[model samples]
Target: MERILLQLSYNGADFQGFQIQNEGRTVQYELERILKRMHKDFIRIHPSSRTDKGVHALMQYVHFDTTLSLPTNKWQHAFNSALPDDIYINEVTKINADFHSRYDCVGKAYRYKVYKAPHRDVLKRGIETHITETLDTRKMNEAAQYFIGTHDFTSFCSAKTEIENKERTMYKFEVIETDTGYEFFVIGSGFLYNMVRIMVHFLMDVGRGKRQGSEIPAIIAASDRTKAGKTAPAEGLYLEKIYLSPEELTQDIPKGTTITLKPTRRQLTQQS
Candidate 1:
């Protein structure tokens, strides 16, 4: 038997979520359906993280075990051939049987996109969240600093979340500018359900003059979810990357994943 790790990307627009449910399509179900056909048996896959419905994943990771022998290089092609266009197997690696995709994950990064336009760009409807008001990025950045350290994030988590331990280490949280919008990048040891989105919404409130950057500490101390503002739209959220190596989880983000802003294709075309 061998354990195989696969890196994938998916547009979560149609998925109920990464996890299997009583109804609706899911990333796991689609991939496993393809796997069962290939192995002639059910193959369970363990994903590193579960994203909300309508959220996207740019570099998600999953691992599975199988006794059926198959070339590591051939795995990607086999799966992609049958999977829907929204889901694609990017790379596959044969890992030791003991390796786990979820437990072994050391860190993760997420990007929440916002398009600050008066009218919604229908093309980006499912890709970016639209906002009509102007924002003070300077104040937003100042608010972001409050989230960049170890803290009990009870106030920022969803009421539906079952996890009791609300403390999570936020290694990095910053607002990056794009020509048409803003991308809120957050790297953390882990997050409670809806934590990142709630945090981002609070920062946005600061930007819009509804709240002050200085209020974050008190809000956090309260540990009340209502204090954090609304959760950001799932469609605008992307699970950017999962970091399993120790280097990426350090208090300071590594060189390769340096927290720098780069204009996206939409921004680039507008600039040109």
Candidate 2:
């Protein structure tokens, strides 16, 4: 058996979520279905991260063990042939059996987009959240700085999450103003359930003059979910990228390999 790693992107509007559920459609279900067809047997794929329903992925990674020995380039073509147009397999590589797509990831980056307008952009609906109120980007950026570094994010996670440890390191958090709206880029060692969405909500609150930027520290110290703003919509979230250690990344893919995929037209408009 050989371990294989694949990089892919998917538009999440049509699926329930990344993981397979008993009833609804899912990205994992479609992927595994295609893999079963290729191998003529059951195959399971482990993803780098789990995204909520309507959360898109720009560069998602997955790994699985397979007995088939197809060339790396052909693997992409074969998988793309069966997968839906919204999902595309960009690259594939052979990897060591010990490498894991999730546990081995050292860091990840996520992006949340918000469009400020009196009315929703019909073209970008369901991909970018629309806010009728004007947002102060400067104040949002100031609030975002407080989220950098390590902290117990209990106040910023969903109440439905069962994880006990809420400590995670925030390597970078910045709010960039775009022509149409704002883009929140967050990089972290790890994140709790709905952590990014809650952060975005709080930042938006700060931008709307409903909260003070200086209150972030005290809110985080509360360790209560009620202290944070409401969770943002899942449609605004995107799994921007996943980072692996130099050693782990080099073990499979060659040096200078570019894993970034070109953003689709919808993604481009959202960023704009």
Candidate 3:
């Protein structure tokens, strides 16, 4: 069997999350169903990350095995025909059988948009978190810089995580104001559950003067979830990109086959 990796994007507002569930519309379930229809057998897909419900993704990655004989470039067209309006395959390629989307990723970048205006736009309401509190963008930007470089992020993760190591590297972190809102971009080797959201929460609190900028180091040192701010809502979060090694990206393969994505909302509705 030939392994291929598919790169895609989706508007996650209507779905429960990225993972397959017994009863909910998910990205995995939709993709899996489509793949089974094509293969007439079970096809397993591995993704770089499982974004939370209401979260979106611009460059999500997944790998699956297929025996189709078409060229890699053509898989994009074939897959898009089966994808729903909310999701689309942007790119497709064959890769080494051992190349895994999750483990092979060097890093990931996520962006959280915050609408800081007095009133929210109808279109913007679902994509961004509306914050009326007057924020010092400069101060927030300055505080976010502290998050760069390697550090123990135990304090910033949600208490739900079972991972033992809270240590991760932050390659980049910045906050910039836009025409109607503020944007927070974070790039890291990896992230803990709710780590980015929690960090955004803390920074928002700092921007509003609810927390001191100088207190960040203390929060990191405390290694306690209670010391951090609330996990930001999932609507504002998006899996922006995944950085793959050159070897993983340049592999050759046969095509006519592609990975599938499951929509999250359908299963949830069925469950209810």
TM-score of each: 0.91, 0.89, 0.87
**What is each predicted model's overall lDDT from 0 to 1?**
0.83, 0.84, 0.80
List ranges where model 3 is wrong by over 4 Å: 246-272
Which pairs clash in model 2?
none
Compared with the true structure, what per-residue lDDT tens digits does model 1 show for residues 44-71?
A: 9999999888889999999899887888
Better of 2 and 3 by lDDT: 2
RMSD of model 2, in Å? Answer: 8.1
Kindly list the per-residue Cα lDDT of model 3 for residues 169-239, writing each as its tens digit: 77667888888778889877789998999999899988898987788888899999999879888889988
CA error at residue 133 for candidate 2, angstroms? 2.1
Model 1 vs. true fold: TM: 0.91
What are the RMSD figures for all models against the true structure? 8.0, 8.1, 9.6
